[model samples]
Target: MADAPTDITLHQKSKILEVVFEDGATYNLPLEYLRVYSPSAEVRGHGGPMQLVTGKKDVGVEQIDPVGNYAIQLHFDDGHNTGIFSWDTLRELGENYEANWADYLKRLEDAGATREKLWH
Candidate 1:
């Protein structure tokens, strides 16, 4: 519910994105984490069951660029980066990381997916 980001920086080596908001809130999001949790319909789908994104444990961020003033474009090293994460959405992701991660873990477990295979 805070303001949008004013600046965004990507640390490619560390595979992390640092976003600074106008309200002074900042977030450091990992590439692997972001890839697995992309907001794209290809990842989330339009309705019904959500597509479980696997094999993203070791995916690195290839590029990070601003999309005007509303969102950011992320390119993954694995050649799977068509998702544009919006500022508000990014903030929500940062704020709900723990809960969302837990849910994702549960979903993965239910889908018989493992992070080990994702990295390999």
Candidate 2:
């Protein structure tokens, strides 16, 4: 069984979600990170390659809806609410934050994408 979240708090000013688990684990996840790494099919891709989501540095979670007993549905200010974040997924994201963020930055660099820069 996975460690259930004991407390979940959203820091709107900082755009961070603080999650404390029953196993004495705590994670402060950035909203942008969660948005980009969303488990939704649109971001994860069906069976091809994972899509590189850009221009979400200012995205924030407007609401968090509980999904049964295992996951959460994050409603983003950018109108993205498709991802259902499970407890395991949240834990994994928190655990691998550093490496995953670094990898994301590298991918963005490779794709000539910027978290802030947008060109029309």
CA lDDT, every model vs. true structure: 0.80, 0.94
Candidate 1 is scored at a TM of 0.86
- Tell me model 2's lDDT, rounded to 2 decimals: 0.94
Worst 10 residues of 2 by lDDT: 111-120
Regions of model 1 farther than 4 Å from truth: 117-120
Alpha-carbon error at 61 in model 2, in Å?
Answer: 1.0
Model 2 ranges with Cα > 4 A deviation: 117-120
lDDT string, candidate 2, 8-95, tens digits: 8999999999988988999999999999999999999999899999999999988999999998999999999999999999999999
**Candidate 1 local distance difference test against the native:** 0.80
Cα displacement (angstroms), candidate 2, residue 68, comes to 0.2
For residues 41-95, could you state the per-residue lDDT of candidate 1 as single tens digits?
8887888666788767777876777788778888888787778898778998888
How far residue 86's Cα lies from its native spot in candidate 2, in Å, is: 0.4
How much does candidate 2 score in TM-score? 0.96
